[model samples]
Target chain A: MSTSSDVDLDEVYSFALDLAKQAGKMLDDAWRARCDGGPQTGHVEKESAVDLVTQTDEDVEAFIKQEIASKFPIHKFIGEETYSKGSSKEYLIGKEPTWCIDPLDGTVNYIHIFPMFCVSIGFILDGEPAIGVIHAPFLNQTFSACRGKGAWLNGTQRLPLIRNPIPPMPQDAPKGCVFSCEWGKDRRDQPDGNLHRKVESFFNMAAEIGGRQGKGGMVHGVRSLGSATLDLAYCAMGAFDIWWEGGCWEWDVAAGICLLKEAGGLVTTANPPTDPSTARIEDTKLGGRLYLAIRPAGDTEQETGRQGQERTVREVWRRVRHLDYPRPGA
Target chain B: MSTSSDVDLDEVYSFALDLAKQAGKMLDDAWRARCDGGPQTGHVEKESAVDLVTQTDEDVEAFIKQEIASKFPIHKFIGEETYSKGSSKEYLIGKEPTWCIDPLDGTVNYIHIFPMFCVSIGFILDGEPAIGVIHAPFLNQTFSACRGKGAWLNGTQRLPLIRNPIPPMPQDAPKGCVFSCEWGKDRRDQPDGNLHRKVESFFNMAAEIGGRQGKGGMVHGVRSLGSATLDLAYCAMGAFDIWWEGGCWEWDVAAGICLLKEAGGLVTTANPPTDPSTARIEDTKLGGRLYLAIRPAGDTEQETGRQGQERTVREVWRRVRHLDYPRPGA
Candidate 1:
């Protein structure tokens, strides 16, 4: 029960960035300790047999929660590790002025000494994220956003993400564009060749974008950085034009969603919204997964902009068609 | 010529790090300049397309060569940009000390303001990489190696990269594990769908590794960091177990070859050697566009003092089956 006019976005954004940096310091300390011990011995719990969560996860989350309580005692707060335990059902999310956090997103990677992890702090007021901050301590990079004012990396400087039309790709564009994807945990449930087909087509379509359907086109390459939040942040910066991800939760994307939107990047389901009118992109509620299309900033050609991106996606989808699997979580 | 007795391991290692950092600083300056200006404006040249090469690439390479000339006056150096232009084919690698440098490894990612790129500098002596250093400035991480002393990250710290046997992967590790494939400048020569199948199988095998494949082992994952050197660097760090790359030149893998081997990792062509006995890894003369695998350190169940890294690699190879492809040059 909040209106834009009622909330002070500038104040909330400042607070979010502060919280994110504090949480990032906590995560960075744990990461350095874990890397020091070598990749394995850092485990504190089991996200899976191979995957792990360290004490830093809990310590960081607790620190963030404590700060939020002191600053805005009336607000609701949710964290990933705690949510994994219980207490968060509709009753909590249905509440107003809630703050969502992933104290250290990409915990497994952090444990394994990969540097793509980040601390995500998102402020959701009236059931929507109004201010978001993503801080990656190792890189000393911070992406912050306040509703309507746009997003900034580091601070103050707005990022305007724009891209040219896709149908007729720019001639100079690399035919091998890169992408970020995840293997997801539920590997056993997929059809025999379905998963393979999906990834294979991803490559195929990248090769074919401006070229013939099966001939190589404009994409030059694809890469997987293994962190959803970082992936989204890069997309917002226009470093990557498209990011397709599956099997991630809202916390994995909420802060990044705000960042991407503020940077003028577009988010849609990997599967097109059945009813675009009702699509709830805020939480990627249209589907369990998300596909983000980011364009670089400029005076863009609207028709070309729509078709170029749509075509790139369609091309990827066409390639993915070779692998036939049920939508995840179905 | 550098014999084990002649090479100053510490000095070369330090110099490599110094060169990488200096290059990194130059790249940083260019990065800031680019950020201040709008996106790079221009057409893709015959040398490279996209505004991929920033002033950073040129400045860093120039700085590296200048340093090499003043410090290692007698040593020959080969770099990406210069090497891309014609050099006397007769200047073939010999039993002389030479340096292979890729000042900014992930140029495209760098131009896009992506943080995954790095500066890779390697020293080759007697036709084999003697010392190597890869500095990823954005991530604030540097990976290095001295032939016999073994590899280190940030120096001083040894990479005790030994992973306890992955408890006989519950699923028989599939032959279709993650493959780091690239869609380079060759698209029309091969159909996109044809290449897509390789990606499809990669996913399928990974998805079914634990369920459909024997022992229900699922294929682990795939990553394309975009830079061939960084890809190998990750493999060297054991961040990735295998990195299969095709459609690249010797400059792409030269420095990485040293670090990969020094990390107790293994490298072999995707296709079997025509004469396995004649496959002299130390001989830089054999240049081909093909497969490369970097295996991590693994403990042998047997108490032999030697690391049983080979057994693990053989086991991995047994699990993976490459998608058949018609030879590119043939």
Candidate 2:
């Protein structure tokens, strides 16, 4: 099922950037052999007890499925710790040339050493996500991309990070921006409203607009840096101007949604489909769970070395959404 | 007022680490002049508009109070943009030899580049915080300490970072450690109960025990990292075991409460006053506007190179307290 004119997207994005830097050097030599003053022990737990999984997340997902089965051993795989056992839920149908993994994502912020975990990879073909890589060997940064060649970091080639690579969203852009979200592992509270619409959308996007009682979205900041593929590669390097989430897993955002759609950034759905007359964002049904990235906007203002931003998409889903969160098994 | 035996404390912690690395190189060259492609702009605002401030947070607090009054020319200052103008509040009294600065402790995450900010300093005399420094130039990390000399980082010397550090708090530990906080500039919702006890103590410390209904703190992760001196210097380099805050300012916890009491932790108060009588956590009234830190514990068991951990202080303040927060002018 490999498309993009019979696969050759720079040799599958240089073999998914050398198997995501060989699963980030076997998770940096097994986190310097059991955390030499960093991670701590090989913490092991899963499917409950605050959901964690370590031993360097099943030894970097069995060395990235044994180096992609010794270099494309008839592709097709899905990782998140051996396709997350039990109660059956391994998605992605039909699209054969696969290899979606989340080798170490944020294993509970890598058993609490917490340096914003990573090492993601994506490939898939006819079913979409062409090629992508994300590495964060302790924030060294490496987001990559293919299928029309755009998203790149730690290797930009495009001089001076494109005169202004990814920083748009500014039509009076929610005051000072830099939103991000997460708090997953569903701890449903309130009359059970996804922790009361995530504490009422993080206190109405960080209160103000007449200060408290003002139904806020005064967003200038509200991060939750416990990785969602480095929260969509830091919202595709616009350094987070918004990131909404929900019970993730398409190996935790198919390589940061291909570096947030090759850094032109938008990606939606923190709850949509409110009678949009057959609402269709390509028939929204993503399973890396409800997301809402945003960083690149549009309405015709961003000029200098453009690449994204003018605010539309119905003005950033009417300034940061949450279309009545609290779904799952409703 | 310079007593700690006439304060030489390693020459005021090497002149507060060369004035916090010269205010982190003049805030990394005024954040590469208006964030070329990073933070986006000057974000001109002060006590509102998402409570921000820029022009490199008043040019890194007038270059860290002009290099600490040109190297301590008879010290005494308090700079959080000059005692945060208007509504009078310049704390730290008697025995004056102060210096407490903040300069750019995450100015809304440095106008939203979102790289947890820093550049703290401290050096009170009879008023205590003998000397400290915190750097974090885009997280290169600095953290310093003095009074009786102990804490350090990015200068880890004193033998393999104190012969293998980053290990404190064990007492049957597995409750998934790491916890840090901040949603500052108060957006208090849920009938303003400190944002409903911070979303009910982050959904009862990230719910579990019979799911949701059993309540939580089954914690293993929860980071906010907008920067309170790099969240008490990443909870004094143990990489966040706990950190709590409150409206912040004694130049942001007088340089992380002297690097969390020189990294042997515990800094109390999210509301401490249910006395078994004379509450003496150094006469708890920390005006960096409420803290909580923790890290090192004690109840005996911790031995060998022990630095702080035996647990008891009413068993670590009844396991991470917040005492139904909602205080500031309740």
Candidate 3:
């Protein structure tokens, strides 16, 4: 197992950035072709009818895999397409250099031409996310970050794009905060199912501040853009104050987590911490299927950045129902 | 009172387009200033706590009104900011040529820097929408149209951006259809309230096709971008197959409806037509509080574009709960 010190972070980040852009170009070409009267790109169901996969998704994954192999032949890889097809259903993230990729993160958006899909590539060292890159061809934006360094957009702008001092989380938070969440492919509506819980939680979050029998959150706004990667990326950019989701794989969030942390944000499990006093952002597991992300905080006389983020997380956790999503090999 | 023929639509459209772009620039400047450490632009509640209005919105609206009045002094005007403050609560759509404008649509998105807000301008002649222009500053894209002419994006690409022959609505749709809807500011969750109905309808639309006790529409995707104007414009662009909503004013849909019609799309009430057999897209009321916009359809030997649209609408209507929203003067 190689330590983080053994890797040249600059070279890896540069390579990942170039690879993400190349992959984005391929996605753009296929999208343009479809829009320009090319044969319709048919899709097939993956886990369910709502979960979809397309030829372009597979092709992009294969292309990315080949390029990485030629450039870093010794590095291991865990890609969405390959994992879905592999006979072994377990994910192995050992303490070694590995690339975790979601070649096409928003497949449904891609098929519908909604212009929110993207390519996400995350590099893990010592079983922790070290470098990340994501490119959205339609939006013409690229976000990248390396551990201990800063996050960036289009390789220029330091993120949270708002360079100004951010205001501390509102006293009545989850209120006056722009929250982002997704309706995952899990549509089972049983009383205890994730879908039912998600719907109830969403309703509660958007309800009047004192409505819903005192359970209302009255969030400033709620957005579901159908792309988890972009959702996390936007959270990192300070466009969203909070993002919560479940039923997503490690590849879905590995890159986004790195970007958010580099931007001075925090990531924790979607569920409330079992030991509130000891809860730490560093304790967040990469393969944890449920995740909650909070934007960086503003320093003030009464509270520091970490204190504000922790308070906001606790407030948000109380408003949401506990969601359950089995970890790989659990 | 000028008839459609009595007005010069080409000249009016040109003026509206230029005005929208100029308004977009102002919005862009203010946004950049706010991001670059300018004093925070404070907001106040208008109709409710969820409904907000900032100084920038008022300034932009005033600027647009002045530009239009100077260019066409004889024309009437109905701007959102002015209407919200006026003594007369009734909306009067006389036969005179008029401009209906929403200076800053998606105020929440703009405040959050979510990049989906826009300035919308619609020209009404003969009591009908004749010219439309919408400019999204952050997105750097503009949509425009003139009656009897074609709709366009950025003055070059034809509307729909998809030149290929679009496929007809699927046999079981809202299934396999990309649907767009919004959770409006009305967050009341009473048993029979619009908010409750909307939540129920959204669940039904996203639930599994065979689940939900056969009530599921199982849409291919559901998007809530927090912008009514853009939702309708995307419908015109053939990206969103269906967009249903209530609680939006005429200024919100007038420009979008014009763009949709010019792109061969259709607009009808969100409620099921009183007499399905007699439901005609041309009969859709501009001031109707509820709306459902459908994208243009492809030609086929068996079904024409209109037929395809009607079929899809009926399918969608049955799957959603009936929602009630009062008209402006009701």
lDDT of 2 by residue, A1-330 (tens): 343455666777898898898788777666555445454555656766567787777877887888788877777888887877645674653456787888888777665555688789888676667777988776666788776677777665321132353444555545457778877665545463665566566666676554445546667778887888888877676667777777786778887787667766757576644542344444124453677766644334544312233232333344343534343333
Interface C-alpha root-mean-square deviation of candidate 2: 10.6
Question: Native-vs-model 2 lDDT?
Answer: 0.65
Candidate 1, which segments miss by more than 4 Å at Cα? Answer: A1-8, A38-55, A87-92, A156-177, A192-197, A209-217, A273-288, A300-330, B1-12, B38-63, B87-91, B160-201, B210-220, B272-308, B319-330
Worst 10 residues of 1 chain A by lDDT: A161-170
Candidate that beats the other on TM-score, 2 or 3, i.e. the better one? 3
Residue B301 lDDT (model 1): 57
By DockQ, the candidates rank as 3, 1, 2
Better structure of 2 and 3 per DockQ: 3
Model 3 ranges with Cα > 4 A deviation: A1-3, A273-283, B1-3, B273-283
DockQ of 1: 0.35
**Could you tell me the TM-score of chain B in model 2?**
0.34
**Best to worst by TM-score, what's the order?**
3, 1, 2
What tens digits encode model 3's per-residue C-alpha lDDT throughout B154-193? 8887877676887666767788888899988988768779
What local distance difference test score does each model get? 0.61, 0.65, 0.85
Tens digit of per-residue lDDT, candidate 1, span A1-330? 534455566777888888888788877776555445534434554544434566778888889999988977767778877876773323245437778888888665665444567998887766666777899896788988888888787885556422321123232333535565555544554543435434544554455444444533346557676678888888777777667766566677778888887776666666544443344443244224445454443333543544455555544443443323243334
